[model samples]
Every structure is written in structure tokens, then in C-alpha cells.
Target: MTEDAWVPLALSSMIEVGTSAGAVVQGQEIVVWRDSSGVAHTWEDRCPHRGMKMSFGFVRGDHIACLYHGWEYDQAGQCRYIPAHPQLEVPKTICVKTWAVAEAAGMIWVALGAVPPPPAEAEVTALRSLYLDAPLAAVLAALPEGFGGTLAGQVPLVTLDTDLGTLRIGVQPIDARRTALHLTVAGPATPDTLLALATRSDAFRLSLETAGAAA
Candidate 1:
């Protein structure tokens, strides 16, 4: 959130070429996608025109076309073309807000501010990522033990021992029922296996949520 460290938003493999996806980062709805040339970009989900969520739009090579009005936006969040105008150059005000993005450790990293610190070397080999429906406090409390020590290296981490490897889960709570958990391993794990490992997190989250509701 400080724009000093790269927060793992989603797995890189999750966004295939020409595919667009959404995630909640820094408490904002972000849409990220890869261009035809395999470049990645991140932007706020709201379209500047009608405030419609841009994630519902379609991808056309390097731009995403909004579903509401077919507004085309490039990776820089600029409105490049409007099917309605066809001739008018989009005003500079009609651009989607963009964030700094980086792909490392098989994950998509988004920096909220300019000049964010570079992502660590280990994050480049992450195994997988998952989401939780509980607050980060609940998620950390539910960890078996010694799963993670610090978060964001200083934010406090809740490390879990999984069959696949040492599962290091970073919890970013968006709301009561939406938390993005980035799963990294200190050992080897295939993408397939890592996806499977995410299932086990369900039990932990369920227990934490249930107990928290009761309390």
C-alpha cells in the first residue's frame, strides 16, 4: 500500500495472452490483462465515461473494449477509440487510471504509487495464489504454526506447511468476505499442484469465519 513493496495480486499464468481478469488490490477493483504481444497492464476497474466496471469488457489485442459503450482503452488507460465518434481523438481526460505493474514469480504485482520498490527475487518463483473470505487477522490466527513470520517481509506473514511445500500466504483483506491470498512456496511446486493445494485453505478460512461470527 505504501508503494514501496510489490504486492502479489494474482498468478501470472492466470492471465493468459489476450485474456482479462479482475482482482482487488489496495482495496480497489483492478483489471489486468496481457496484450497480443504479451505485455501486461493494470488499471482501475471503473471506466471514466459511465463508471461501469471495465473488467466486463473484452480484449482486442492491446486494448480492452468496454462492454457498455464499446469504448476502447489501451494499457495506459487512455481512451484510444470510440465507436460512436470514430473520428474524434479521445480527450486526455477520458482515460482509465493506471497503476505500476510487474510480472514476477508467476504472479501479477501491482504497485499503488509511482516508483514502487522492486519485487524481491524469491517472488519470481511463486507456486500459486488463492483467495479467502475472512479478515487477515482470522487467516493468520488459523495458520497451523510457523507458516509465515513477517508480513510483507515486515508486514507479518502467516506461513503454512502444505503437502506441496511451505505455503506462504499473503493476506490482503478487501472486505468482510473478500481477501486475496497470494501463495508462495519456499520449495518446488508445479502450477497444477499449487492450485490443488489452495483447496486446503478453505477449511482454515471457514473455521476462522465461523468463529469470528460467533464471537
Candidate 2:
């Protein structure tokens, strides 16, 4: 994955304020969280102190504390406090690797290095995410139409036009044969339209999985 490209990490709704979630992008484990102020942050899932998975940690104010040893790291990924040594200033070196994260069109995006430009402004609402046991290429090839844009020459993101409205789908590769399809529909999606879109997406995923199995 290119450092300058943004990969879809998770739906914005997946991470509420004071909460965190784990995600895998291109086989790299990532921890995505939202602070009390509603800002989203992403970092490597491992804690520097004990190599613990930070996704299991809890969020307090603007920081995430490791569940193992109570080591707290601020949004910038720098260790700020240690329960074992309350009065001691944490060493600057005790920090987790952080990544640039942005929320737009109701989706969370993260970059491995330099943050890419945000997607074009649009009036879109998140629909749903579907996971498939298929390769990213096979999934993209199976798309009906209007899903032609590629981010970083690998991630497949497409905008589909429907009678109800326009919809966007971000294709995230989980591994060699698994993927997470994140969907966003152009607003304003009525209850009926939302249901229709979701049904269509589910059908598409089913077809893809069936084809993969047959192959």
C-alpha cells in the first residue's frame, strides 16, 4: 500500500466516542478509536511497552489505556501516564506508532504514512458493510457497474448510480482471500431506499461468494 493513499478502515459509526475497534488493512493490524471530542485516531495495534494489542484497551477522555498494564497513550500515540508510576513522567520513547486518520462521508480512512487528500465532498450516507470470502480482484470484477475508481492503485472504491440515488462502495482487502465491502449511499436515503440498497448489496455479495466457491 502506498503511504500517501488512504485506506478505508471502518465505518464512522463503528467507533463511538470513548470507544475503540480493531481493523485489518492489507494484513496490517490497526486500532481505530474516537476521543471524547469526537476526533478519530488510528495506530498500530501493538503497545510498545509489552506488545499488547491496544484494541483491547479502554478510552478515557482523549487517551487510550492499555488493558494489560494500565499504560495510557494520548491521541498522538505518546505514552503520557503509567499506573505503576503515577508521579513519573513517561519517556518520550514509550509511544505507539500512529497513523493519519480522517472521517468523511460517514467513513473512517487511515493512511500508513502521509495522509492523502480527502475524498471529494459529497452528500452520502453510510449504508452497510459486507464481508466476502473472495479475493479483492474477483470482487471488483463482479461489481455490476460504476465502481471503477482505485485508490493507491490497489484499493477499489466505486460510486454507483441508482434510481433512488448514488451510492459508493469502498473495497477493503482483509487478506489473500477475504474482503470487507463498505457501502455509502447518497442522501437523503429513505427507509425504503436504504432497505433496497442493502438488499441489492447482499445479493451482490452472495453472488461473489458463490462464484468464489465454485471456482
Candidate 3:
């Protein structure tokens, strides 16, 4: 067993009740989704059979049925039905791996290893999250200390910012050269302003990279 942490997976809006957010945490492919009952669930992205992606499967209330074979699994990642073998209790080997998951501040956080307690949301106001092509370092640099202290309303961050020792930024790798930076601004503001800042910063990052490439 290794030391584990619960990383913010996605913004609440990105994952609808019937949709899933695909992420790779600590090198493990994971799919976090919400069922029809309004509960969030996390499981390995791969199916036990034929390595089909379970994230593509459809949700039926509390169960997730594989899209390819219609095999169903429960919240506990237990294989509930085989479709073909409707009356038989599927063995454990047929189940997909799962982990403890919870929602915090309108976003879902999933632990990769021994999961910690669900994140408590007290002052953390749900702010919009975005996908950035740049790395976390670049994203932080672009911000003016949380964008010139704009995040006054957000609190008790779902993610722990180890670098700043204050608010945390949830950073996920999209590729060797790119990362998705999910950051929470302090609180309420003009959505138009926030969007403009994000957009401009992204454009600047692209320009910087292009300049670097030409050198």
C-alpha cells in the first residue's frame, strides 16, 4: 500500500446525473459518475471482461450496466447481473474496481489510495472550473495570488494547495506537456470578468509557448 490523497476530479456541472468524468489519478484510469439516485460513484475505467471502458456504460438508478454486454454493477462495485445469466450471482472476479468518492463544494473528489474522510464544505463556494492547456505552475503564475485576491468567498478548499500553503489548486495531467488546472476563485464575482481573465490568460500562455518554440 502507498500513501494516497483525494484529488478534485471535476466541477459539478461537468458530470451530470447520468454522465461520467474520466480521469487518471496516480496513473490509474478512473471514471467518476453520478447515478439516477443523485449519488456519485467512482470505479476503475476498465471492465473486467475484454477491458471495455466502464465509463462508457450507462447508469440505471444505482447500478451501472456495461454498454457492450449489458453487465450490471452496484455502487459497491459488485457485479450484480450478467444479463445472460440473469438469476446467477456473478463472482467477485467479474466486478470492476471502485473507490470511495464524495462531493465537496459542487465538485467531486476521489481518493486514489486509502481514502480520507469526505471533504467538509463550510466556506467553499462553488466556483466555475476550467480546463487549461498549460501546466499548474503556469496557471499559478498567471494568477495574481488567486487572481489578485479575487477568491474571497471560497473557503476550506477541496484541494490542498501544498505550494502556497493556503488555497489549493487541483492539477491533473492531460499529457506530458499539458495539464488541466482546476482552481477555485475566492467567491462571487462578475462571471463575465472571470471568464475574460481565464480566456486572456489562456491566450497569453499560448503566445508564450509559441515564442519559446521559435527560440
Candidate 4:
């Protein structure tokens, strides 16, 4: 993935304050966590120390600690504390590589490189993310015709006008063989409408996955 493109990692509501979750983009593991102040950060999933998955760690006020040895890293990805040596000052060299993160359109996005394009700015209601085992190209090819909806725009972002409402979709390339669709309503939608959209999305996922397996 190019550093210039911003990829949606998770739904904003999904990653609550003081929590962390694992995500992958093009096969690179990433840890997405929110601080007590509700600011989100993304970093390499590996702990700088013993190479433990940072997503398996716990979150303090503004720090995330690796579960391996209680190694705490501040929001800046700098190791600020070492429980093994409380009195010893932690080395500044111990820090997890971080990526530029942004929240827009009710989703959390991470830019792989330094010069990331602007995040997608749109007023939309969050639906849910759909993970599919099929290739992204196949999913995109099938989306317009499958939903009985009018599809517009291009990959990475698109719009589908359905009977319920217009749905804004952010395409995430999980890897070569997997893809994710971050779904949101383009405008105001009632809970019933959101539920219906979600159900329809689930059916599409099942159909795509089944066809991919057969292929």
C-alpha cells in the first residue's frame, strides 16, 4: 500500500476510549488504540522489546503496555516506563513505529507513510465493517449488481444508493485474498434502516465468500 493513501482501520465507535484492537493492511500487523482522552493512535503491532503483539497489551490513561513484561509506551509510541526497573530511566530508543492516524466519517484511518492524503470527510452514519475472504477486485465487481442499488464513485471509496438510503463505503485492502468494507449511511438513517443495510451486507459477504471458495 502506498503511504499516500489513508486506509480505514476500524469504526470510531468500535474502539472505545482506553482500548486497543489489532488490524492488518496488506499483511502488515497494526495496533489501533485510543487513549483516555479519546485520541486514537496506530503503531506496529510488535513490541519493541521481545516482539510481543502490542494489541495483546493493556491500556492505561495515555499509555499502552505490552502484556509480555509490563512495558509501557506513551501515546507517542515512546517507552516511558519499565516495571522491571521502576527506578531506571527507560531508553528513548525503545519505541514502537507509529503511523499517522485520523478519524473521519465515523471511522478510524491510518496512513502508512509520512505524506498521507487527507481523510475522507463526509457526514455519514456508521453501519459496520464487512470482512470478506474474496479478493477486493471481485467484491468491487459484484457490489453494484448484487445489492440492487445504484453504485457510484471508485474503489477505496464509493456510494451505493439503496431503497433504505445511500450508503458510503470505504474499501480496505486487507491483503491479496481478503478485503473489508467499512459501511456507513450517506445521510440520516433510522435504526431500522441501518439494521436492514447491515443484514443485506451480511448476505453479500456470505455469497462472495461461498463463490470464492468454489472458485
Candidate 5:
């Protein structure tokens, strides 16, 4: 994906409130977190203080504290507190790089540069995010061979019609050699059906990886 493109990082259900997780988009590390009020934010995963990954930290109310030295950053990515130097006022320049974030179609998206028109709003049932040890192009090419769904939409966002329902999938390029697919159902589905779809996806992943290894 281009630097300006909005990349879907994770499934919306994956990052619970007051929780954070590490993600990679085209090789760039990012931290996805939600505050107490349930607003999601994305930022550079590295801490400016000691280069530690902010994903290793814990969330407190609306702030996320770096595990290294208890450096806390608010939802705006501004450093708000330092445990070691309680009386020291943090500089305005001390902050993490923030990204534009949005939630739609059961996925959390992050824009690396200028935000484009947001993904069209739709009601969807959250499924699961699938990661594969294969290139994005390869994964897309092999998708039809697996689920045999009628695929539609541009890259990074697509839909596949299956027996269960229409699957709204968000694609993510984790790197040159890895990709992620955030899936959600557009129509109602029972617990058993969802489990079956998930289980079938696991078989698809195994087959894809095995084929890549053989090739």
C-alpha cells in the first residue's frame, strides 16, 4: 500500500477498551490502543524515551504508559507524565507520532498520511483476523482457490459471497512476506456457522502456507 493509503490494521473486536496491541503495516510498526471512553488510537509503536515498544506498555484511563520508564502518553499522543521526574514538566516536543484512525465495517483502520474518504459505513458482524506467512499478492491470488467466493472491491477491502453470508474482508500488508485479512459477515449467522467458517479458514491458511513452502 502507498504511504497515503488507509490500511486496515486489526479487527475492531480484537482491541478491547483499555487495551493495546502491536501491528505492522508494510513493515512499519504501529501500536493500536483504545482508551477508557472506548476511542481507538494508532501511533508509532516505539517509545521516544528509550526506543522501547509502546505495545509492551499498559493502559491507564485515557493514557498509555511505556513499560520502560512509566512514560505516559495521552490519547493525542502527547507525553503527559513521567514517573521518575514527577516535578519535571514534559516538553511539547516529547510525544509519539500519531496516525489518523477510524473504525468501520468491523475493522480498525490507520492512515499513514492524509486521510482519504473513509470506508463506506456498513453493519457487519465481527469475525476474526487472519494472518498468513505469504505475500499479499500471493494471498489474494490464492483466495479464490480456497473459498471459491465471488470476490469484489478494490485492494485492501473486498467482499466474498459464500453460503454463510457476504464476507467483508479488510486486507493488510504486514510486510513483503506477510499479510493479514480482517473478516466480518454482512448478514446474520449462527454461532455454529461462524465457527465453521473460521475452521474452514484455518484449513485454507494451512494449505496456502504449505503450497508456498513447496514452491
Candidate 6:
């Protein structure tokens, strides 16, 4: 993973406001959450104090409270309040590691360091995400015909020109052998079209997995 490379972490729909989801990028656990104001954030899964997984924590407005000791952290990853020491002002040094997070094309993107520019503007509607048991290279090789354009920095994107509209497909590698496939239609799409695209995507994933298993 390059320092400036943006990896698709999850679908924007996966993390609702005041909720958090755990995602893995290059084997690193990440806590992806959305604030009440609809802003999205990503950070290292561990809390600074006890190294507890923050994904298991609860959200309160703009902050996330660790389930273990009720340690509260703000969006900046800074320890805002410590239940054990209410009168003490949390030290700024006690902060969880954070990453650059952006949402576009109906997906969440996280970068280890600086994030590149957002994806090109498109009237995209997210269809759904598919999980596959294959390497990123295998998944890319298995992409159905018609995909061409790339989004953010991830490559081998599939762009299908359907009767309804153009469909863009993005793939995120969960690890060496696991992947998450995200689908988005380029223009206004009907429910029927979205369903068709999802069905086709599932079939494509099945074919890839079957071939990998056979190989």
C-alpha cells in the first residue's frame, strides 16, 4: 500500500450515522464510523489506553466511547474524556492513530498518509457490495467485459455500458485471498437495473471463486 494510495474501505451505506464498522486494509484493522452530522471517520481499531478494539465501542453524538473503560474519543482521535478521571482533562497526546478518510462514488476510502484527490464526479447510485474468496489479481482477471475506468487510485475497475446506463465496479482487497466488490451505476438507475447488476456481480464472483478453487 502506497502512502498516498486510496483504498476502498467500505460502502458509505455500511456505516450509518452514530454507528461504526470494522474494516481491514492490507491486514490492518480500521474502525470506520459516521458522526451524527453524517461525517465519516477512520482510525486504528485500538484505543490508546488499553489497546481495546474501538469498533466494539458505542457512539455518542460526535464521540466514540470505548466499551472497556468508557474512554471517550472525539473525531480527531483525541481522548476527550476518561470516565475514571472525570475532573482530569485528557491529555492531547493520548490519541488514537487516524487515517485520511473520504466518501465518494458511494464508497468509503482510507489512506495511510495523505489522500489523493476525490474520484471524478459522477451521478452514481450504489448497488451493493460483494465479498469474494480470491486474490485481488484473480478478481481483476475475472471482471466481466465492459469495465475500464478507475476510481480514486484503485485500478482494474469495470465500466459496463448497459441499456440503462454505465455501471462502475470497484474491488477492495480484504487480505491476500479475500475481497469486497462494490458496485455503482453511473447515472440514474431503476431498482430493476440495480438488481440485475447485483445478480450479475454475484455470478461473476462465483465464477472467479470456482475457477480459483479448481486451480
Candidate achieving the largest TM-score: 5
lDDT tens digits, residues 24-139, model 2? 88788999999999999989999998899999999999999999999999979999999999999888999999988877777888888776787555667778888888878887
Write one digit per residue (lDDT tens) for candidate 3, span 1-215: 11365666776667888776577654578888888888888889987877888888888888888878988888888888888888886887778888888787556777767877776663343344556555444554544443443332221242433222233444555444455555554344356645655564466556645644665
Ranking by TM-score: 5, 4, 2, 6, 1, 3
Give one digit per residue, the lDDT tens place, for model 4 in 132-169: 89788899887876765888987667888888889888
TM-scores for every candidate against the unseen true structure: 0.82, 0.89, 0.75, 0.96, 0.98, 0.88
lDDT score, residue 128, model 3? 48
Evaluated at residue 170, the lDDT of candidate 2 is 73
Which stretches of candidate 5 lie above 4 Å from their native place? none
Assess candidate 6 and give its lDDT. 0.79
> Mind giving the per-residue lDDT tens digits that candidate 1 earns over 164-209?
5665555555655566777677757677775665555555556666
Pitting candidate 5 against candidate 6, the one with the higher lDDT is 5
Model 2: per-residue Cα lDDT at residue 101? 80
Clashes of 1: 12
Error of 3 at 197 (Å): 3.7
Which runs in model 1 stand beyond 4 Å of their true positions? 1-4, 123-128, 145-153, 156-164, 190-196
Q: Which structure among the candidates has the greatest lDDT?
A: 5
Put down candidate 5 lDDT per residue, 1-215, tens digits, no spaces. Answer: 54877789998899999999999998899999999999999999999999999999999999999999999999899999999999989999999999999988788999998898887778888888999999998888888768668888877898888877888899999999999999899967789979988997898899999999999
**Candidate 6 ranges beyond 4 A from true positions:** 145-158, 162-164
Model 4: which ten-residue window has the lowest total lDDT? 113-122
**Between candidates 2 and 3, which one is better according to lDDT?**
2
